[model samples]
Target: MLLGYRASEQYNSYYKPVYYRLAESGGQERLRELLSQTPSIQIYDTIESQLSELAKINNPQRQLTPEEYKVEVARYLDGKDPDEYGVWVYYPWSQKLVHLLDEEEFVQVRTSRNLYKIKPEELETLKTKKLGIIGLSVGQSIAMTIATERICGELYLADFDTVELCNMNRLSNCNVYNLGASKAVITAQKIAELDPFLKVTCFTDGITADNIDTFLGTGSSQLNILIEECDSIDVKILSRVKARAKGIPVVMDTNDRGMLDVERFDLEPERPLFHGNLNEEGIDLTKLKDLTSQEKLPMLDAMVNLSALSDRMKYSLSEMGKTINTWPQLASSVVLGGAMVTDTCRRILLSETTSSGRYYIDFKELIK
Candidate 1:
């Protein structure tokens, strides 16, 4: 019911450190180790073998028409081994060959129900758009959401930080096994396993002034949308400056009170960066670093009207590393943020009625 994964897949989708049995490191070694313990490994001779079993289930009466059988048989007669044609990935604990579905077919099947609502034309428009996500804490959920929904052609993921124990509170993908792994690398690997064809570019060192151009696709096609989520206020401002200069739209989710921001530099080339929050020409963004809770508060106030935020958020900000080392974010807010950003991105890229603005999914307001 949830993106083709059942509740049983919860651990695999969110909790476990994602592992595969293929070309990735430790892949062959892990497979050999597991296979040594088990008596046999499972494999379907071809995709046709699996299809035949399904056909039997679909028609135990054996009443399939001659035309149906011919069409079905012709489906497999493309002169290539069905299992061999596509990339293969084995999820942890799976006991058989897991041939990834064809890229186009996978997208179509996974997002089939999202049609008409998202609109077929809108989905098509999203197909070729390039998206970028910086910082993989909240960004990780956003990346996974975008991947599952097949919203963009390529996803540029930027995150320099490695997993830390504190990160586990909100990063559903974090686990003890990958405690110190690079966030960008781990995310890229997960995306590849999810949709082999979902193009991914990782910026393990995170975006900087020198590399911002490359991350924004300067030498190549510019990104259609940027989902900025980095901790460094410097990169945050710098990225938008580049985005504004290049005429690319930007998106950001604060993961507090379900806050999401949209800046349409593509629509209005001269639009001020961050809606004038960084308008002071003298402000040296390069001097900025990952802000402490107190340092972030005043900057946040300028970016957002703090009065509009929930009481809980206002209370948390007052503590500033005393009661809280940083901002408090919940899984619910992070998940909601991912959906909000992607939906906003879709609306913008499709040239819909959606305009550049800020919106919220305030739980306090909603619950009341």
Candidate 2:
């Protein structure tokens, strides 16, 4: 009976098009209001509407199945010459759609614009570039950001850590079922599900000095950018050195007290500050790696006597009981850092003049 009533209501709704049309016409404004009241609904409707429009345009003849619609969308967006092969549709904001060379361009237009504010030419550039990300915790956020841009042709993910229950707060790919799974694998799976053509290489062992060469030196042409979100200072320094050697820029993100710090190490052989001035005499990287978590805490505490480093340790020890676990710090740092990194990457890829030096964002300032 409920089904019959629903059917009848639908029929009546079709007949009374004016009311439905009026409601639908004002839906965008109502959606803005609903977003404030119920955020999830806004997210759902926004993604659904855009995807639905994408489906309609891709399959105007209404012959393609839902799965086919997704495939067609991916193909259209990722294709080399989207305008030449497919129909070009104009979005509301920009005047960039010149031709429908292929399916990939459609995907590029849909995902990039939805995820970030990127110009048309910049979107095109993203399709041809490659990115390497070390550390999958915050790296997952970076991947999601890059995937949304649809700019990168391939993504190299390196992480040794597996997902834990505590990681759900920050790592997008980590969940109940995925606990104990290697972060790189889970992140690669997520990216594959989003866009099957997104070429991904996962290294479950994490990036190390020995294996770093193989990971980055795939001989598949030049890498456009490298993102370092690894926990080890040694790995971070090594990555910068390798990028500098290869003439590729490196971007790193850090978070402190809800504020983000972005550092861009552009390709320069004579870069002044190599690794943010570490007191090499106090701590040996090899010895530090072998120390237990508890032992490592005091060692780290003693190694870097800087007030900022000590303050961070004090806050962490007070909250987590001095094991020096990296999860909380990583979680807080990675997301905000990923956003800043993504924005910086966009600006760089677009050939826009962006501040390449260190940048800091204090959320408290915004509250003031």
Per-residue lDDT tens digits for candidate 1, residues 1-368, read: 65774433322223122334344466667656756765555643344544443444445577777677656645644555453443344434334445544456556655666757888777887888899999999999899888877788888988888777788888776566666677877677677656767788888788888788988886358898889987677777888888988988889998887888888888888887767765556667756675565775666676766887778888887786687787778888888888888778777777874477777887777897
Off by over 4 Å in 1: 1-74, 78-97, 290-297
Model 1 clashing residue pairs (backbone): none
Q: Pick the candidate with the highest lDDT.
A: 1
RMSD in Å for all candidates: 8.0, 15.2
TM-score of each: 0.77, 0.63
Candidate 2 per-residue lDDT over residues 31-59, each given as its tens digit? 34434654333111132334445666545
Q: lDDT for every model?
A: 0.72, 0.58
Q: What global local distance difference test value does model 1 have?
A: 0.72
